[model samples]
Target: MTYTFTCKKVPLSDSVKEYAQKRIDKLGRYFQDDPAVHVSFSVEREVLCAVEITIRSGSTILRSQSQAVDGDMRGAIDSGVAYIERQILKNKTRLAKRLRSEGFPSVVEDVSFAVKEEAEFDIVRTKHVPVKPMTAEEAILQMNLIGHGFFIFRNASDNAVSIVYRRNNGGYGLILADDME
Candidate 1:
């Protein structure tokens, strides 16, 4: 397994490394044989602290990133990890089917899904989305793996159509549909 840290504007400190270690350990089980961990820390305008964490396990890879507008690295890491956990729990079945890891949970419990009530307005609107269950993290990995600047996928989090693209800042950005009207 390899661990990599990238620092920009913000220096990687012992405390930050320690905190990152703690954070990644929370998702240790998800990692497979010889997993590679990459974390990027950056500061924008000397105010915002941004972090992007990428974990590669065998042929399966996922990336989760969080930014602290207040420039708190630790908080950003916590939020990023929480996002990953939620994604894992929500798509536990989907992920398990795709990724063969003993650390992955077998059952999908306490899952939440929205229920839309029928309306008798005689009008219904629908948009086509990729049925493949994938999160933003997977989208990014796929994008980079293919050497593409951007990639689009169905967001497993909210079932929203989303796009992940590379930014000029050496980081990635996600765009979600805001309005269909």
Candidate 2:
């Protein structure tokens, strides 16, 4: 696995970088192969150190972030690496569930989990008279009525797609995708 280390507001040390790279490289033990990990270290408020680790393979992404108050940068890096490893384990359980649901054929030498792909087309489905604006509560009701997991509607305030969907806790969750230039 390849590791990329980037530092901000702090001088990069060879020892610190090597320690982080070696620590996260252990993630390969849980799976058949390891995915490349990206580590970003930054200093906020010139005192607290922040590290963000992102492991990506194709369409799948696993990320974890942590911060520490130690003056030593190596301590923060170690904490971040531990956080990332824990996150990967959590993701492994999720992958196991998906494999059980969709069926796992074989465990190859590479990343053992299979990635599912989905595509959406932008065409006319069932046209409506007017795209009415409503609150997230209304969207949840409409989604339940249509027997769909999610319902997208224009927010009366921002005119954006604010989605409401069923959660495993028997409650609804709202997704508000932001629009940025």
Candidate 3:
């Protein structure tokens, strides 16, 4: 597996690089031949340390990030890696389903999909769903009932359509699409 560590707004240190590489090495078992891991470290306001980890195997990509305000870069990196692993574990079922449904060939098959004609974007594959008029609260409820991260609907008040999605911080986010223009 190949590991790429990038540092931003922080001085590169051998200890820091070695520590990140060591942590990344633990993820090698998840892929064949030590999947390449991309690790990025950055400092913000000279107080907050951030670490991002990205692992890619074929078309499957898993990523996670973490931040620490106490200036603990190692802790931030470890936390980010752990969060990524947790995400992988949590989405294992969905990942397996996507692999099966999306024809994500077996790990043994190293064939590239770039040359395949079917790999191109297909308009017909786009799902056209109708947006019903409802309040943001209603959309949130519906999204929760359907176990979906997002729900699109027309606002009952203004008759404009919008989207409501779940946020990473256990909150809901809204995307308003104004047709007033």
TM-score of each: 0.57, 0.51, 0.53
* Model 1, CA-based lDDT: 0.76
lDDT of 3 at 72: 94
Where does model 1 exceed 4 Å of error? 98-102, 105-181
Looking at candidate 3, the ten consecutive residues that score lowest on lDDT are: 111-120
Give candidate 3 regions above 4 Å deviation.
94-181
Say which prediction, candidate 1 or candidate 2, comes out ahead on TM-score. Answer: 1
Per-residue alpha-carbon lDDT of candidate 2 for residues 109-167, written as tens digits (9 for 90 to 100)? 36434443223345878755455799887887888887998787888888886778887
Model 1: ten consecutive residues of lowest lDDT: 112-121
lDDT of each: 0.76, 0.68, 0.76
> Which residue pairs in model 2 clash with each other?
none
Model 3 scores a TM of 0.53
CA lDDT, candidate 3, residue 111: 29
| Models sorted by TM-score, best on top | 1, 3, 2
Q: 2 or 3: which has the higher TM-score?
A: 3
Of candidates 3 and 1, the better by lDDT: 1
